[model samples]
Target chain A: MPTFADRLAEAVRQKGPLCVGIDPRWESLPKAIRDPLRDELPEERAAIGYFEFGRKVLELVRPFSGVVKPQAAFFEQIGPNGMEMLQLLLREARLLGFVTVLDAKRGDIASTATAYADAAFAGCTVDGDSFPVWDADALTVNPYLGRDAVEPFLTAAKKADRGTFVLVRTSNPGAGLFQDLVCNGQPVYRHVAAEVANWNAPTRGACGLGDVGAVVGATHPKELAELRAAMPDVWLLVPGYGAQGGTAADVKVAYRPDGLGAIVNSSRGVTFPFHPDDPDWEAKIVAAAQKAAAELKP
Target chain B: MPTFADRLAEAVRQKGPLCVGIDPRWESLPKAIRDPLRDELPEERAAIGYFEFGRKVLELVRPFSGVVKPQAAFFEQIGPNGMEMLQLLLREARLLGFVTVLDAKRGDIASTATAYADAAFAGCTVDGDSFPVWDADALTVNPYLGRDAVEPFLTAAKKADRGTFVLVRTSNPGAGLFQDLVCNGQPVYRHVAAEVANWNAPTRGACGLGDVGAVVGATHPKELAELRAAMPDVWLLVPGYGAQGGTAADVKVAYRPDGLGAIVNSSRGVTFPFHPDDPDWEAKIVAAAQKAAAELKP
Candidate 1:
């Protein structure tokens, strides 16, 4: 199997570096998807709705995007059934030839961290055969617990030809409250970015990008540009495009001049382009994904 | 419904401040637990073993400890069946009158964060009847995502009379990489501690602790003491004891003079003290939990 970075680079060359996000919020989903849910249980119904919405998003965006980053929380909200739904969606992403990044932000230490890595990357094995529980091509990791917390993820990803994106500069409003704090004469995010760069060496691909990636939010263009240079070997998963108020121009700063280093993502803006009542929702979603893909071209 | 702090305080007063961690690693499990493998699959047997081990531990420790902190990653590794096992174990904790602090480390932004909160604290509502998912009394959160990622957790915790403990100065060896970085003349974890203090105001209890708490590792005694002083109203969930190399004296710093603040946790040291081949495993586990409880006594 090719390294995740190599596979990602090939995918990017085929489809512009757009990473469509599948974030299906229960209340915001189209009634068309929600109405036909089989289970009477709200969580079950909502889980079904989320799965179908994700399936549709995959179908629409597979032609235009290199990656599909599914936010874990949206599916996790509905409990076990939701997780079951998420597992299927992940397998679907692989089957459809799209790079799947499970945006779980999972972080821990020792055996616990190893368990998370196994679940997300190499997956759980039974007998001689292995089952891909998440089977994600890559994962978004939190570095708060430090290196030991993230090492298992890197080790597992490397072994499986997968990748991981460490959170560096997030796009949320309160992100600056902690990330901007000056640590060692520089911002905390910079330190995180530096570590991300160091971790990349273990699985650096022929494309000059490493399996270890960095999540640099498009909300802070200046920081994004700075981090881009700081972690040249790192692939940046740039969120905050579209609905998060980050424009395409803001996200462009994260990409290299050669247009092969960053993946700009749009979730609600692409998946739920219309109100809940819209009749022609799927087409609009496809159109929105296309527009996002074109606009995000570096 | 009493506030989470109120309930926690009562539980602690009745059972002391020991928080036994449920870390069901496969290899370390007792021979008796793993020997009964009717299933052909390893993960299936491992999942069953983990669930049974958790059940036995809950039964043993419920009499001596106020809380049980189940490491989420261990259960998540076996797919949705493992999650179902975890859900059952969480329910078991509730039935046994122990406050469940799910060590999920889940953090995200906006509605995604809200979804995680609902899954952990508020419980997912389906068919007009709300279904408790993890339904933990409190959760351990990763603060690397900043305040917005943590806000929904606090809000839902407040609404549901639950609680959360945001990671401050972790006990891991590489925790200093970013956490101890001097930002704006103070460490990054200090800034995180300050924010935890701020978030606590929304759900302060009569005992003076708040629904929003801090996870200060036992390995970092000085920082734990400093963070304790910095956030007086915050409930601290201190991990990294025994098996993680932190002594009882190190964890003692997190407690208030009144003996009512921090909850010290012990995982492998308590849960898997005897070798996997030990015949009297239950007795050993009980003894370990007891010793840990006594050592962590305020």
Candidate 2:
């Protein structure tokens, strides 16, 4: 099986570097979607609404997007039923031939890390039986626990032929509070970038990028470009491109000159492209996705 | 409602500093307990077995322990069914007057962080309907995403009168890989320690401690004492007491002179006290909890 980097590269080549983010906020969803969330305590109705939106979005973006990043917290917010919906939607996205990045940001160490990897990728295990749980092609990881914490997830991704994006320099306003603090006369994110490159080096696919990737905020174009130079052969998953005040030009430097090193994500900016009252909400979502895809063209 | 700091201080004063960890590893369960895992899929049998072990452990430790730290990854490995079991265990512990700390290590930014805080402390919401998911008294947070990542959690915790423990120096060997790096002429964790104090300062309860706490490993005795003084008003949730090899004397310095600053944790040491084959395993678990409580009595 081809690694996630290879698959992602193929997707990018076919559909440009656009990856739709399925972050279904309740208030952002149109009434048609939100009306069905009036179910009982189990959130069965809400789960259906959430999955329906994602299912529709997957279909809408299938022609324009190569990958989809579903924010786990959003689905997880609706409870286990919502998680059930997440699993179903992810499986649907995979079946539709989109490389799915489950935005879980899970981090831990040793066996704990292994358990999370199991739940995220290969599935859960019982006495002697293994059950497929969240079938994500890739996952977002936090590297706070160091090498041991990240190694298990990497190993699991290798086994499953999937991938991971390590949070390097996040896009939020307060990200620099700690990530940009000087360490060895450089920001701390630089050290993490070095480690991410080290982790990626051992397993480069035919695309020259490894299953290991880094998430450098598109909002920080200067840092993104610096990190891009610092860590070649690393696939960058750039967020904050649209909704988070990052322009297409700001993210241009994150890509290789040949335009194959990065994938730009526009979540709400593209997905929730209309006011809730817009009767043409679904049409707007599709139009927005197409425009965003074009804007991120390499 | 009283703040988590006030409640935790009272619990410690009543039952000493011992916080029993309910980390139910499926492989670690006795043969009798693991016998019921013959169900098809959905991890129903496995969830039941995990919950059974946890229920027994909670009963065994309830009398001697002031608090319980349930490692979320263990339960999460079993999938949503396991998460449901986690909610039940946490609720049971809360009903029995235990200060439950969900060791989730979750971190994110903006609304994503809010969703996680909701899942951890309050509950998942759908429109106006709130599903009581975890209902933990407090949660362990990963601070790698900086202040914004942590602020939503702090806000949600305050709303629920709950609390948070930010990871400073973890108990694992590889924790120092990034945490100990010299940043601005000091170890990186020192910077994190300062921020934890900054976060803690605003929420000081009558006990002279705040709802925002720091998790400094008991293994690093010198660092523990230094962090204690550096964040005097911040409560310390010290792991690495028994199984991780931090001796009683090593963690003695983690506490204030008046014995009110820290709570020592012993997961496997207290929870998994005997070999699975031991006939008197339950008694041994109780004895271990009692011994650990005495050791951490300060």
Candidate 3:
């Protein structure tokens, strides 16, 4: 099996850099989808809707996108059944040749972190064959506990041939309140970016990007450029495009000159299509995402 | 409903300052316990063994400890069945009169964070009357995503009268590498500590502690003092007391002179009996924990 970095790089090359986000926003689905869900309980609606929508999304974007980032919170909101559906969705995505990134921002002490890595990547079964269904190719991780906490994920990823994207700079408005704080004349996020690069050094893929990646928000264009420069070998998973107020131009700096180093994610922008009176929401989303990808093309 | 601060304060007064961590390390259980689990599948053993051990732990510790911190990753490792057992264990802890701290360390963007908080503290049901059990009284949260990510937990916590402990100065060796970075000539964690105080101010209990709390490692005695001083209103959850190499003296600074402001945690130290020769591990654990609590008594 090709490493996550190699797979992601190959996808970007084939799909012109578009990575669709499978957000499964219940309220945003078409009325045909929403009407049936209205009668079901919130939990049932979310679970069934998420599975149906997620599978449709995978099929819809399979021809146009390289990877699919599933927001874990949406699935988790519906309870364990939703999680079961998420597992099935991940399997479907893998079958469709899309790299799966499970967006679970989990961080803990070393021992617990190891357990989380085992849960997300390596099967938890003692025999390994009859494990849980949903093991993503990559996962989003929180780096708050510093290097020791993150080391377990790295070790697990190395052993499992999986990948992790550490939160260095987020796209949310309040992110700058702490993440952008300058410590000794260098931003805290910059320090995290440097660490991400260092962690990825030994795991550099055939494409030169490392298995360990950094999540640098597209909303911070200047920081995106600087972080990209700082972590040349690290794959950048940039969120906050479209609905998060980031333009395609804002995300351009995240990619390498060759356009193979970054995967820009748009969650609500692609998933929620019932914003106004747009007749063909799905087609519009596909076009918008393709356009965004085109704008970021090298 | 009593706020988390009020409940915690009352518990502390009733059962000393010891907060036992219910980490069901698979390797540490007795031969009778391990013998049944040795050949069973991981999922089956995790479901049966973990629930049985955890239920017994809750029953045993309820009379002595104020709170039981069930590490989420341990149960999560076994998949959906493991999660079901976690819910059962949480229910058992509450039934036995011990406050449950779900040590998930989850942090994410806005909407997602709300779902996690709801799943852990507030029950969400689907089709049947049976809902996913909200077993925890409080939860451990990661602060990497900044204030927005944390606000959802705080919102739900205030509404449900629950609480959260944000990761601040951790016990691990590499904690200072990122947390201690001098941002604008002040350590980053100090800023987080201040925010914790501010967040807790609105939910202060009669005992002068806030519902919002900070997780500070007891190993850093000096920083613990400084963090204690910085976040006077916030309850401090001090980990790193035993196996992580922190003593009663090291944790003393976290509490006020009245011994009313902090809860020091010891997981493996209290749970895993030192002498295999001891006939009863439960009795040994209770005695050792009682001794530790007495040493910390003001």
- Report the number of the highest-DockQ candidate: 1
Worst 10 residues of 1 chain A by lDDT: A124-133
Ranking by DockQ: 1, 2, 3
Chain B TM, per prediction = 0.97, 0.97, 0.94
Q: What C-alpha RMSD does candidate 3 show over the true interface residues after superposing them?
A: 2.6
Q: What overall lDDT goes with each candidate model?
A: 0.86, 0.87, 0.81
| DockQ values, each candidate | 0.69, 0.67, 0.54
For candidate 2, lDDT tens digit of each residue in A1-298?
8878999999999998888988987777788877645554446767788888899999988888989999988877777677778889989998999999999899987888988888888987665678877879899999887888899999999898888999999998899877887877878899999999999998799989888999999888899999999999999999999989999889989888767889889899888988877889889988998888888887
Enumerate clash totals for all models, in the order shown.
Answer: 3, 0, 1
Question: Which regions in candidate 2 have their CA more than 4 angstroms from the true location?
Answer: A37-42, B37-42
Candidate 3's TM-score reads: 0.93
Clashing pairs in 3: A183-B183
- Residue runs of model 3 more than 4 Å from their true location after superposition: A29-45, A125-133, A275-296, B37-41, B125-135, B274-279
Docking quality of model 1: it rates as medium
Error of 2 at A206 (Å): 0.5
Chain A TM-scores of all predicted models: 0.97, 0.97, 0.93
